[model samples]
Target: MREFLIIGSKAKTDKFSLNDLPGAGRIDILCRCVSSAFFLSHDIRRDVNVYLLLLGPPDPPKVIKIVGREVKYMPPDERGIAGLIRKALEVKADESWKKSSPGIYVAKKGLEELLDETASDVYYLREDGEDVRDFETKDGLFVLGDHKGVPRELEEIILSKAKKIIGIPTKSLMAEHCITILHYELDRKQLNS
Candidate 1:
């Protein structure tokens, strides 16, 4: 069934982020960092602990989920890191957890926070704007959510991407907790083995 949130809808993927989450990891690695950026050659390299990030066509935008935050939107460049300034959280965030990795965190509450953001940025790319820009690459002048306020259709796609990568998070893997949807998948994979 399709699960719809207050302002969004979730088309159940065949799977979710079990690949890049705790349940599926060979081992677990977790961390506690809000968000960070490395000095890349051009713009800043901001890495949001996003559960999902999607960039679609026509108009380009992004949807991302960060630690303690819910789904939110941002404008990213074609080849740069995510650009997320702030967001209006849809749910209460969970900041309490074991430190693990950048943007990735562990919390007692599973998906407790829901931000209105995303890492999937899409724009016309044919056009440009103030604060709205894209990077020209060999592929094309692809647009990104270089700013904030991404849309929902793109968010779903990112969530869909998270569905594919399979593995346990490096740190902060929850050995004892309510079995998340992710855990169920990991269990099945183990059983198949």
Candidate 2:
């Protein structure tokens, strides 16, 4: 499976209204990231997983895990996905993951703990990294930052753990766009294989 971990540096951890997703530290961006990660023309990519690492006010460091294979009732729109995230935030969580809704899990885990849990090859997405077109695409974990970008300290840790830093051979792009491009590359590789 392909896994995506998006670092929402300023995304709110507390519950947010569906109407204020963008204002909620650009939760809209995170929602879009989710949509891009799993949604296709007529179906959801059940083999993918999207992780949102939210670090914002009131409460911080909430990780929202969306498992595609198990996820049901996920709407194709941004507002609908945001609703799911809002509901997840409402559920009280500890270090352990708590299921708030179908296929959505919330926890108080931060970046370091999450890195420890994933056993897949970790690839950090950066504009200056190796061109994605030059490498083989396979099942692995892809790490990226939201609009605010990953924290400097956390980025250092990511670089240390990443198997390689991969990028689309272009100028800086939006986080969601990067996800779409990555998915396209992976899909092409899958089809050709």
Candidate 3:
């Protein structure tokens, strides 16, 4: 299975106004990334996993996990998506990785902890990194940062843990677009393999 780790530098870890998915001026981007990761040609693909690291108010950091086939309450728009994530965060704060609902898990863990737990080959997506097409592709986790980009400290952690840094050929693309392109490339590789 393929996995994605999206770092929401300002995404809230508490309940948010559904009407304003941009609860912290960046939650909307997280929603879009989730949508792209879960969507397939006709349905949600089962082989993908998305992890969102929220670092906003109420709670500084929280990890939200979405497993495609297991997610029972997917939202069609950014608002609903944000709501689902907020709901996940509503769970009691004592647990580190508690399942708030089907296919969704909330934890106090941050990006570094999640990456260590995943134990998958990690790839950091960067604009100046090696071209994805030329690099060896495998089933693993892809790490990306939101609009403002990953914080310097976090970027350092990612660089230390990542097996490689991947780059798309074009200018920097949106986080969601990068996922879609990576999926297509990986899919093509699987077909030919």
Candidate 4:
């Protein structure tokens, strides 16, 4: 596995609206509010590299989503949401950067802090348009993304890892969430790896 990207978030407003968008194969997961069955759902795209942006304050120790009958948890705090989203956007703005860096990316910085030490290594990218910080953690490496969703660059690695979790052939996409990988070489490599 390239790495494990566990995104713990409370507000997934953007992810919920993805079905309304013109696309396919998003994360194929859902982020839900605590104590609620409501969730943000998107299918893993076969073409574009996409992320679900949460539109709300960051909070943790809460239920974020129910992906495939599994419960995904959040940090219980969202104070860092603004900063995380910005960095996520920066990653999305440039997929060319992925060939160089690879790791997990998420939408909230607070979530990074909440990840149990079990997380061996993580790549945390946080941006605010005012600043873009990319971090690599060889041991317990974690990053906090605020506004923008997981960048395409980092998504490359997450997509690779996702296959290990779900064991299904995944589709690839561009930074804009458009189906870009017709022959999905990246997905192929991820599956093979």
Candidate 5:
């Protein structure tokens, strides 16, 4: 399975209106990342799982997990995806994950805590990192930061824990674009094998 952990450095942690995703600390970006991570031309990619770490005002850290294999009633558009996030934020969550919707869970864990619990190899995505094309094919927990980018302290921690720092052939790509390219590369490698 392909697992992704997208950090929303400024994404709001409270319920937000559908019309103001951008205003909600760019929750719109996270919504698009979710769409790119699992949705194809018609069907959802069941092999994929997405985690959103929201760190914004009123709430510093809230984790949202979307399991494609079990997710239901999720739409492909940003507004639809944001709706799910809004719902999740409305519920109370703690260190343990709480089911907010089908295949979607919310928790109050930071990046370090989540990484400590993850069993798979972790790949940190960065523009200046090693090219992903040269990396071996494997299922991994890929880490990405939203438009604001990973903070300096967090970057250091990720760099220390990640199995490898990898990137696509391009520079400064959007978080969603990076996810799409990663999936494409993985799909290509799987087909060739």
Candidate 6:
């Protein structure tokens, strides 16, 4: 399965207002990234995993994992998505790594820990990196940053751990857009192979 990690530098760990998801001021981008990661054509979903490294709130840092195939109900809107994530976090805050539902898990581990545990090859997405089309397509983990981009310290760690630094050869797309393009490219390559 393909894995995508989104680092939310200011995403709150606490519960947020469902009515004001965009105005809630904590998880707007996080919600958007999640929505993009899971959305597909004709309501079909992709078999993938999304990891959110939330760095805002009372707890500071927390990792939220969502499995696509296991998701019982995926919200089409940012508000509902944010609510789902908020509820998941609230229900699984204490667990180190426990399933709150069929497709969702909350873990105490941060980005570094999660990357180390995954057996898939890790690829860090950046504009200056090599073009993805030129690289061999395979099941792997793709690490991305939120609006503000990955933190400097974490980027350093990611660079060291990544099997490759892949680029899209554009002016830098949104995290979700990057996912879609990468999946399309990889899927096409797989089909041809």
lDDT by residue (1-193, candidate 1, tens digit) is 1011111112111122323322211111111111211222443234223332222221112223344222222223311121121121112224443333334322222121323222233212111222211122111111112223224564454344332222233333221121132223433554655
Model 3 lDDT tens row, 29-110: 9999988888876688788899999888868788899987788868657887887887887897643778877899888887
Instruction: Give the whole-model CA lDDT for all candidates, comma-separated.
Output: 0.24, 0.91, 0.85, 0.27, 0.91, 0.80
What's model 1's lDDT at 182?
29
List TM-scores for all candidates, in order. 0.19, 0.97, 0.95, 0.26, 0.97, 0.91
lDDT at residue 76 of model 5 (Cα atoms): 99
Candidate 5, which segments miss by more than 4 Å at Cα? none
Looking at model 4, which ten-residue stretch has the lowest summed lDDT? 129-138
In model 3, which range of ten residues has the least summed lDDT? 16-25
Pairs in steric clash, model 2: none
TM-score of decoy 1:
0.19
Worst ten-residue run, lDDT, model 6?
20-29
Candidate 5 clashing pairs?
A: none
Candidate 5 C-alpha lDDT tens digits along 139-167: 89999999899999888888878999997
Q: How accurate is candidate 4 locally (lDDT)?
A: 0.27
Look at candidate 2 and tell me the lDDT of residue 102. 86
Clashing pairs in 6: none
Better of 1 and 5 by TM-score: 5
How big is the positional error of residue 75 in model 2, measured in Å on the Cα after superposition? Answer: 0.7
Candidate 1 vs candidate 6: which has greater TM-score?
Answer: 6
Model 6 agreement with the true structure over 103-130: per-residue lDDT tens digits:
8788777777888888889999998889
